[model samples]
Target: MKMGMRKPSLKKSISARTKGQLTRRIKRTLNPYYGKRGTGWLHPKKKLYNKAYQKTTFSFWDLFK
Candidate 1:
């Protein structure tokens, strides 16, 4: 009998990636995991990449949206 490969679950795919991205984002925003807090920190080696610019005026409601 021949067996075929099954497609990945859509729900699992989205949730998995979403959780991973959010986790990394939160970790990087906090201290310890992220080394310093200035220009030198963005030297590629110790840079923290985010979806948007580091500096933004995102209010409490705006963050949820």
Candidate 2:
């Protein structure tokens, strides 16, 4: 067997608690859903949707009445 087919593993010296904390921190910084308006939070498509939501005033009753 060659090392090319083997998967890499972290050092056993690192504790499980440290690994969990690191993963949580990494997720917090890299997540797309946790950012502010100027970050990845807002986009052109979202703005268009918001505009449509605010301006739309259609009523089915008006047409029938």
Candidate 3:
């Protein structure tokens, strides 16, 4: 049989220790603002403002009006 003819397995398995380590790594990466804002702590407000600004220019008009 050719290697190219092999069927892919639909299931993936990982050890519990590996899963725990991955969870720890993710937690460590997210620990800075853990309880305060979760993963979006870095740019939450800026992202919100950018989205709002992109939808309208009324804020600029108010400043110069």
Candidate 4:
């Protein structure tokens, strides 16, 4: 398991910040349970993705970057 900050992906960083807003908005609008409780079961892949993302990513507040 990756125990520290993930290797940066230029494409992921740029596109994640720039694109997919509409998709996010649409998902939130269509699903009342979106981003809320029981999402792990409802979307196991998303849950796993989030778990891995959290483990491997860093925040803006991180001094080391």
Candidate 5:
């Protein structure tokens, strides 16, 4: 679990901003459990890691390069 600044990746950041909308739309269309609550149960470990990562890590302006 990374606890401080997140390692930066331009590609990942760019993908996050752009891919979110399209993938969300696709998930909403094709995934039966897209927006349902408690759906994280399907992938508890991944969900837990992401939750921790969000709370514990942050990005620095210079880290992008």
Candidate 6:
């Protein structure tokens, strides 16, 4: 047998399935907030509001001024 050869274990397979399910659930939950539509969480509209809330610095002043 090769030193690095190993049989796949049931635990690994189950864990992989569980992780996949969890990822799907998270995606579904966050889909409305971060989907491809223009109204998602990271959408430009939302991002603009976030930027407005951020503390402006000299760099922004130069850019906006």
Tens digits of per-residue lDDT, candidate 2, 1-65, equal: 12222232455435546886787678788985553456533577876765565455433333566
Residue pair clashes in candidate 4: none
Provide the lowest-lDDT 10-residue window in model 2: 1-10
* Highest-lDDT candidate: 5
Lowest lDDT 10-residue stretch of candidate 1? 48-57
TM-score of each: 0.28, 0.25, 0.25, 0.57, 0.62, 0.27
Native-to-model Cα distance after best TM-score fit, residue 47 in candidate 5, in Å: 2.4
Off by over 4 Å in 6: 1-16, 33-65
lDDT of 5 by residue, 1-65 (tens): 78998778899888978988789889999988898998987899999998899899887874667
> lDDT tens digits, residues 1-65, model 1?
11233344778768879996887778778856453446455565534333122333233444467
- How many collisions per candidate? 0, 0, 0, 0, 0, 1
Evaluate all candidate structures by whole-model CA lDDT and list the values in order.
Answer: 0.53, 0.54, 0.53, 0.74, 0.86, 0.58
Query: What is residue 63's positional error in candidate 1, in angstroms?
Result: 37
lDDT of 3 at 31: 76
lDDT of 3 by residue, 1-65 (tens): 12222233333234445675787678778875543544544688976775565565443234556
Off by over 4 Å in 4: 41-61
Can you tell me which runs of candidate 5 are displaced by over 4 Å?
61-65
Q: Which portions of model 2 show Cα errors greater than 4 Å?
A: 1-16, 32-65
> Per-candidate RMSD vs. true structure?
13.7, 20.3, 18.9, 3.4, 4.1, 18.7
| Candidate 3 least-lDDT 10 residues | 1-10
Residues forming the 10-long window of minimal summed lDDT in candidate 4? 56-65
Question: Candidate 4 or 5, higher lDDT?
Answer: 5
Superior candidate under TM-score, 1 versus 5: 5
Candidate no. 4 TM-score = 0.57
1-65, model 4: which lDDT tens digit per residue? 55665567778777777676667778899988777876587678887988888877776447565
Q: What's the lDDT for residue 12 in model 6?
A: 74
